[model samples]
Structures are given as C-alpha cells and as structure tokens.
Target: MRKYLIFIFIVLAVAGCKKKNKAVTSTIPGKPALTTPAQNSVCISGTIISATESQVLFTWNPAVNTDSYDLVLKNLLTYTSTTINTIDTKINATLLRNTPYEWYISAKQNSSSTTTQSDGWKFYNSGAGIVSYPPFPADIMYPAFGQVITPSNGKIELYWAGNSVGNNIASYTVCLGTTSNPPAIKNGLTESQLKDVAVTANTTYYWRIITFDADGNYTDSGLFQFKIQ
Candidate 1:
C-alpha cells in the first residue's frame, strides 16, 4: 500500500507539470492588427515645414502578451525607412509633402525572441493645402542607383516616375554627365523615359531629373550614378 501511494503521487506531479507547460506555450503572442490610414489611402493632408509636424498618426490593435511595438514607415518613392519603438498602440509621424509612404507595426514580447508584424498600409501626404502642395521630385526607375553595366552595353535607358499631385506635370528635363552635378542633357522632355542614351565604356555617369509643373513650379531629383563596363 505504501508503494502504490508513492506511485500515484509521482504520476500527479508529472501530469501537473505537463499541464503548466501547455498553458505557457498557448500564451505566445500573435500578430497585431493594423488600423487607421486604411489600406491604399491617398491625399492625406499635412503641414510641410522645416520643423517636424505630426502629419499622420498610426494605430494598431495590441497583440496578446506583447510588451512593446515597433512602427516602420517607408517612403515608397525614395526607398527610405524609419522605425520607432514604443509601448503604446499608437504613434504620430512626420512625412514629406506630396509623397507616398507605406507603414507597418511589429508587436514584440519582452521575454520571447518572436515578433508579430501587422499588415502594411500605404498613404500619400498631400501637404498643408492644395496651394501649399508642390509636385514631388521624379523617382528614378531604371538601372537602379549605383548599378554597373558590364560588357560595354554602350547604351543606357533612363526612366523615372513623375509626380502630379495638385498640379499637372508639364515636362521633364534630364541632366547626364561625368560630373556629380551634371548639366542638362535634354530639356523640356514630355516623356517619363529616355532610351538609347549613349555611354562611354569604363566611365561613371551621373544623372538627375527636373520636373516642371503647369503652374511653373519645379522639383529636382537628386543625382544618381552608374558605371559602364
């Protein structure tokens, strides 16, 4: 009878341990749900100033067992990103005028190495008012920044995305040369792409685009460089 009682006690202890481990495993956090700015939202109004303005506020539903959150904002056109860590469910960020951005949130637990990412959403900042908003600079598309063309292609194609927000884009001017700040190779171009650009072998070429709006407002895309074989 004494041996039987000891065996029963050992079985109960092992069962209790297994039940506790299962409960802990079930408490692992899940992905957070993103809210606000709705997906593919456009023309969000905000102030454009030298000082940072709380242009847009991002929010998400808290994840279970999460201790903190990381919010990431990315400029779709410029390929720049910003991340903010917080314990709160919401955050405000400053964004550029007349630009598109994508954002998401990650829920994290303090004790675990796992992170849950919320669904991403995109929005466009319209900037202050209709009159205050200017057309954004062109975004380069082809031959990505700092790419090298080998085997002497002898020709390159330049492509970019032109912005037309409150105003219509009138024309584009392209500058391409060996210098960092190259002179205009073509001005008053009506197209978004320039093809068959002659290039010299074993030379780095710098290029940029200047976009003009019908309202006489203009914006410049910073310089980008590429090398030929």
Candidate 2:
C-alpha cells in the first residue's frame, strides 16, 4: 500500500510539471546603436578599391532581442541605396570614393514580425588625393515630397538638415514657386529653417535647397513638392 501511494504522488507531480507553458517570452527589438564611421564624420580608414571606389567597414552595437540586421547604405549624390543583411554586428562594403553617403541598420527577430531601425549617419568616403568634400544634399524635414497640408496660420515653415566634412558650410539657398523649376526666393541664409512663408490654399508648390561650402563647392538638395489644402 505504501508503494502504490508513492507511485500516485509521482504521477501527480509529473502532471503538474507538464501543465506549465514551455514557450519563451518575447519583446520588441531595440534600435541598434552605430559605432564606427561615426555620425556626421569623415571615413578615412578603408582599402582603396580603385580611384572611384573604396571598401568601408561598418560597425554597430547589438540591439536587444534582435536576431538579424539589415544595413542600408545610400549614395547621397546619386540618390541610390543598397541593402545588406547580416547576422553579425560589422560588415565591409565597397562604395564610391569621394562621395557622401548615409547609412542605417534595421533589426529583426524570427519570433516577431516587427522591426526596429537605428538612426542614420552620414559620412564622406575619403580617397587618395581628395582634399575636401561638398556638403551633403540638404535633407528635407517638413512637408515631405507630395505631402498635403493645410496652413492654419496662412504660412508654413520649410526646414532642412545639412552636413559636410570639417563643417565647412557657408550658406543655404531656398528656391520655391509653383513651377517645377522654382526660382530662388531666399539666398545666403545661415539658418536651417525658413519661417512665416505665406502660402495659398488649394495650390501645389515646388522647392529645393542649395547647399554651398565655404570653399565655393555646392550641392543641390534636388526637388521636393507639396500641396496646400
């Protein structure tokens, strides 16, 4: 009788253990932190592939609950982008020399469908015999291309961000009008924003930014447009 009671107790304990959940807990992926080719800095350490290209090493800190990372590298001059996937923290890529580029990392996990992206960083790929770099094309921050907005105050602000090697920026030129090729409405502005620009309702406007370095090198921000409702 004593042996039977011990066997029943063991069976009951096994059943209790089997009832517990075996699945692991899950959480959203954290944003990756960039390490090398630091933000808004020049990248001078790389193997020279040729007069037009160089191999760059990209490194970043690991994010929590991330299983993989996708590196997005964009040529700011040509407006072209490349995507690379890896399960590691660092990678080597060959890119165009003497050009400005921006990069970011997207983190993903197999257990979840969501993804996290890290902040973007811009760098100039220095090549042999290169002396200076032009400012990166101004990044349009407000009223994105083709965005429709209503100006309650009869005006809207235009803003942009610019960067260059050695911080050699001189001024920015803002061109705005209804035509695709707008004329310069403002020039030699040292600020990043244009405030209190009057607008008309139910009209589309086109604009672009021209960034000039202190050495007279200039880069266009390309064209962007928005509609006022």
Highest-TM-score candidate: 2
User: Alpha carbon lDDT of residue 63, candidate 1?
Assistant: 88
Give candidate 2's whole-model lDDT.
Answer: 0.91
Clashing pairs for predicted structure model 1, backbone only: 46-128
Q: Model 1, 1-229: lDDT tens per residue?
A: 9999999999999999999998878445678888777665554544445543436778888889899999998886676899999999988777776666778988888888888888877666764444643456677887678998763257778899876555478999999999988999899899999888998898988998998988887877778898888
State the lDDT at 137 in candidate 1: 65
How many steric overlaps does candidate 1 have?
A: 1
RMSD of every prediction? 6.7, 4.1
Q: Top model by lDDT, which number? A: 2
Any runs in candidate 2 off by more than 4 Å, and if so which? 1-24
lDDT string for model 2 (1-229, tens) is 9999999999998877766543334568999999989888888898988888889999999999999999999998888999999999999999998888999999999888999999999998887786777888899998799999889689999999988886889999999999999999999999989999999999999999999999899998989999999
